[model samples]
Target: MEVNLIVETLKFLVLGMSTVFMFLALMVVVLELQAKIIMKYFPPPKENSLVSNSTQELFQKGNFSVVAAIAASIRSYKKKSK
Candidate 1:
C-alpha cells in the first residue's frame, strides 16, 4: 500500500508539472501569434514632410526655376532652410 501511494504521488506530481509546462508553452505561442498578427496588420508610422508649407509657398510664387534648382541641389540646403 505504501509503494502504491508513492507511485500515485509521483504520478500526480509529474502530471502537475506537465500541466504547468503545457500552459506556459501555450501562453508563449499565443503571445507570439498575437505579435505576428499585429505586426502584419499595423505598419509603423512614416515620416511626414517638414518642408511642405515652404514648398507650397514657393510654388505659389513665380519661383519655379528656383524651386527646381533647390530640389536638384546636392548639399540639401533647401531642407535646412525650411
Candidate 2:
C-alpha cells in the first residue's frame, strides 16, 4: 500500500507539471502568432525626417530656455541622488 501511494503521487505530479508546461507553451505560441498577424495587417508608422528636421531647426533657432530647463531638472535630480 505504501509503495502504491508513492507511485500514484509521482504520477499525479508528473501529469500536473506536464499539463502546466503545455498550457504555458501554448500561450506563448498563441501570443507570438497574434503579434505576427497584427504586424502583417497593421504595420508600425515610419519615422519622418521632416518632423525631426523641424524640431532641430527650432532648437537651433534660439531655444535655450527649453535646454536650460532640462539641465536644471537633471542637476536637481543628481543632487537629490547624492
Candidate 3:
C-alpha cells in the first residue's frame, strides 16, 4: 500500500507539471502567431515615405509629429509586450 501511494503521487505530480508546461508553450506559440499576423497586416513603412513625409514637414515647422509619435509608441509597446 505504501509503495502504491508513492507511485500514484509521483504520477500525479508528473501529470500536473506536464500540463503546466503544455499551457505555457501554447501561450508562447499563440503570442508569436499574433505578432506575425499583426506585422504582416500592418507593416511599418519607411520614415521618408509619403505617410511620414507630411508629418516630417509639420515637424520642420515646429509642430509635433503626433501621428508618427503615436505609431512609434504603439510599435514599441507591442515589442515590449513580447
- How well does candidate 3 score on lDDT at residue 79? 100
Which ranking of candidates, highest TM-score first?
A: 2, 1, 3
Model 3 accuracy (lDDT, Cα)? 0.82
Error of 1 at 59 (Å): 27
Task: Report the lDDT of model 2 for residue 30.
Answer: 100
Task: List candidate 1 stretches off by more than 4 Å.
Answer: 1-3, 44-82
lDDT of 1: 0.79
Top candidate by TM-score: 2
Q: Please list the C-alpha lDDT of all candidates, in the order they appear.
A: 0.79, 0.81, 0.82
Candidate 3 per-residue C-alpha lDDT over 42-66 given as tens digits, one digit per residue, 9 for 90 to 100? 8888565555446567778565757
- Regarding TM-score, does 1 or 2 come out ahead? 2
Show the colliding residue pairs in model 3. none
The estimated TM-scores of all candidates read 0.47, 0.51, 0.46
Residue 46 miss distance in model 3 (angstroms)? 8.1
Question: For residues 1-82, could you state the per-residue lDDT of candidate 2 as single tens digits?
Answer: 3579888899999999999999999999999999999899998776543444343555686767766776798899999999
